[model samples]
Target: MITEAEKWTKEFYQKRGWSEYGPFIRIGFLMEEAGELARAVRAYEIGRDRPDETKRTAGELKRELVEEMGDVMGNLIMLAGMYDVSLEDMMEAHRKKLTERFKGETS
Candidate 1:
């Protein structure tokens, strides 16, 4: 499903005639993603400072985290599309790096 996300993003951009501004759009998307992350961190701080508040539950913080994660995924999908990179390939590369690092093969 996540791999298909990249394909859908490419098609969406193509349909909107946005292929020409891929680089710039991706930069903007990354900025938006960073803002969402900041918002999530602020929400976490708010919850952390009021642990005794029954009105603010852990579920609310989880929702905020998921929202920020969605933003990150969306931007990453867009960036991969802009660069014509496959999400599957990236994941494989990451897995290989993780395996090596965990095995003490490389730093």
Candidate 2:
């Protein structure tokens, strides 16, 4: 089944006429998405580390994290769409690379 991420990504490209762009543009978009994730994580940390921090509860932190994660996922889906990539395929490729890096005997 196509996910919301897929739908958003398709709309994003369709609205722009699916113009071809350099790979670097996608890389930049990924970086921006990563930054958003980092910001969310930092917010969670700050919300958790409070001497007298009773303002934000854990639930609030979780909500913020989820929102940030959604942003990350959305951006990733958009980037993958831009490059005609499948997330499942990308994950499999990533797993293979990681396995080779960590499990391969050859130095």
Candidate 3:
């Protein structure tokens, strides 16, 4: 799935002429997406009112949060692709690092 996402993002970026952007630019985008995700989390927890609605429902907030999360993940995938790193490999390395660092600390 990560590989497929990377492939799709690469083509999508290229189609939009964003392929020329360097890792620095990609990182900026990733930061923006992270901010959006944070905002989504806040809205999901406390709720927010749209222009047409007095307040959003929990389900609505959750759906928006999921979309924001996807945006963050997509940006992350793009940034990693810029550095030729695979998300799948990164996840594996992260798991290994935590396993080694924590040992049996986790129950």
Best by TM-score: 3
Candidate 3 whole-model C-alpha lDDT, 0 to 1:
0.82
Per-residue CA lDDT of candidate 2, range 35-95, in tens? 8778768868764455775667678877878987876676677677666777777888998
Candidate 1 lDDT by residue in tens digits, 1-107: 35666677667767987555666777797788888788777777664455574555668877878888877776777777666667787888899998977996566
Off by over 4 Å in 2: 1-4, 8-30, 48-54, 104-107
- In candidate 3, which residue pairs get closer than 3 Å at backbone N, Cα or C atoms, i.e. clash? none
Looking at model 3, residue 79 earns an lDDT score of 78
lDDT-based ranking: 3, 1, 2
Range of the 10 consecutive residues with the lowest summed lDDT in candidate 3: 46-55
Q: Comparing candidate 1 with candidate 2, which one achieves the higher TM-score?
A: 2
CA-only RMSD, every prediction? 4.7, 4.9, 2.5
lDDT of each: 0.73, 0.71, 0.82
Worst 10 residues of 1 by lDDT: 47-56
lDDT (10s digit) by residue, model 3, range 9-91: 77887899887888888788889988888988988886555586567778988998999888888778777776777998889
The best candidate by lDDT is 3
